[model samples]
Target: MYGAITAVKDLALTVRQGEFLTILGPSGSGKTTALMLLAGFISPSEGDILIGGRSVAAVPSYRRDQGIVFQSYALFPHLTVRRNLEFPLEMRGIKASERANRVDRILKRVHLKDFGGRMPSQLSGGQQQRVALARALIADPPVLLLDEPLGALDRNLREQMQGEIKSLHKEFGITTVCVTHDQEEALTLSDRIVVMRGGVIEQVDTPEALYDRPATLFAANFLGEANLLEETGSDVQAERSRPFGMVAIIRPERLRISTRGAPRSPDADQRQSVIGMVTDTVYAGAQRKYHVQAGTRMLTVREHVASGQQVYSPGDQVRLEWLRSDVRFVTP
Candidate 1:
């Protein structure tokens, strides 16, 4: 067990070598604890952790042979970029010639080849972050662990660095485990995402599966915005009564809105359409979000608010309809 809190249940996840697995959860969800435990910073109280098929629960931090990066960058302010990249090599007693060559190569790879002489304060936030990543990769550890590495940068820089990190992972082919709270970041970078809640595993699958078929109510709500609706009492069955709870989860994008009196198709099922009055419309780039009030329920619909499209305002009566396939049954 890596930094996972023992009093709270910890999930045992097996990450294959050279795969990019992301531990994703909200704050205090044990994602960071799991990363810490895997990095050998903290010991598991009960169970053991295995790396490369060997039990590594007794391994000390310095002997774990894993490189770690944190949100704060943790770059040494007093050291020049070259020195910062060289520090880990120096600690390992790598030859000066090899150290210089590796630093030069990584500096170029991270696009900081010309800034080797600059101090941390002299570089931009993004540049300083790249230096930190370069330093982490300089040692070439077998496994790489990251705890919200791009959380500090602005939106644009964060997106740019996410690409850089993905590219770097491909170039190195090292097994990586990242901890992040950002859904899009996890979706974009991870080969598989392990979603956690209350220090236990909620679901572990590719980003697409976790998003489209969340196993639990918490997993459904945590991954993205979801509209949860209770099924009518008549729809309940004996076998699914306790586990399924007659609830359905629908993503915002799965709904479509039609004005009152619009003709319904012959195949349109009444169960999939809800009568609602437009309560709000938010103009988001690429798509607009419409909040519709259907009786006591509020349904959100995402539609492209393109030129020549019919725009509905507040108080307009509309029907929010979706396909039955879009409705995912969540575990109660």
Candidate 2:
């Protein structure tokens, strides 16, 4: 709590051993604060943090058996990569021989054995990132914490590093908690995700479950493109599966768009159809997105770009349909 402005309030979470958990949220959502609290950068006004069923709320950051990788890489500019990797071990009082061995093994593990003699300034962004990760793991800490570790890389590099992080996690089987605002990063890396809003946990579930079955409108909209069907409610009022006091939302990918005169599917009776005019069309590399104006709501539809598939223009009329079961109801 900073000057009475509670950054995170009543937060409760448990990360299982060897599980990769991600705390995802936008700016001011308190994800960083939560990570800081767990890292012992700041003490929580209330509630205790437990590691392996043992309370460590009062433990200092350095005393806790945890490794951390920051977004900046945070390598010492003057130190060689090998020296940076060895720093953590030296701090922990590991002998010189053991430190050198551990550094060599870790550098090889990150595929940077030969680059160790170079200073941090000599390495590229990706190389520096690997060095940081290796430095964090050189001491073999029980837990790993990542604070937007890939934020400094470009799109392609970020994607590449995501695979690297996943492979390392699988190999090490360390319980890791990462904080990031990137939806794709969270979706791709997390075994389970905790979505926070306004300092409170909005939802917690597996990546697939969180995206497919969000419990609130904020989560549904935050994770991906959720088309809120304001007028769609009337079309599917007879849907017995829809709960009371909920609004309907469907993913842009779940919705299909066809020409206005196109024939209905064989299971038309089991779907909801709406007529709308295309407001815009986007040609993504592998997929196409269409913005359609239906009733009072503007809906976005995404489909793979396939051969022989008709492309709609801005003025073209289109019909959108989706399976009744695809319509998820979430709290407003």
Q: Evaluated with TM-score, which candidate comes out highest?
A: 2
**Model 1: per-residue Cα lDDT over 1-332, one tens digit each:** 33443523756788988999999998878888888888988877878898878889999989887788989989999999999999999999999999999999999999989999999999998998899888888898989999899999999999999999999999999899999999989999999999987788889999999999888888888888888655321232222233535467788988878887899857585336777889898998899989888766777888876898888899998877777667777876
- Candidate 1, residue 282: lDDT: 93
Residue runs of model 2 more than 4 Å from their true location after superposition: 232-234, 237-239
Q: How many residue pairs clash in each candidate?
A: 2, 0
lDDT string for model 2 (1-332, tens) is 99879999999898999999999999999999999998999998889999888888999998997999999999999999988988888888999999999988999999999998999999999999999999888787889999999999999999999999999999999899999999999999999999999999999999999999999999999999899888742466325567888988899999989999999999898888888999899999999999999988999999999999898999998899988888889999
Could you report the Cα RMSD, in angstroms, for every candidate shown? 3.1, 1.3
Predictions in order: lDDT: 0.84, 0.92
Clashes of 1: 2
Instruction: Report the Cα lDDT for residue 183, model 2.
Output: 97
Off by over 4 Å in 1: 1-8, 231-246, 265-271
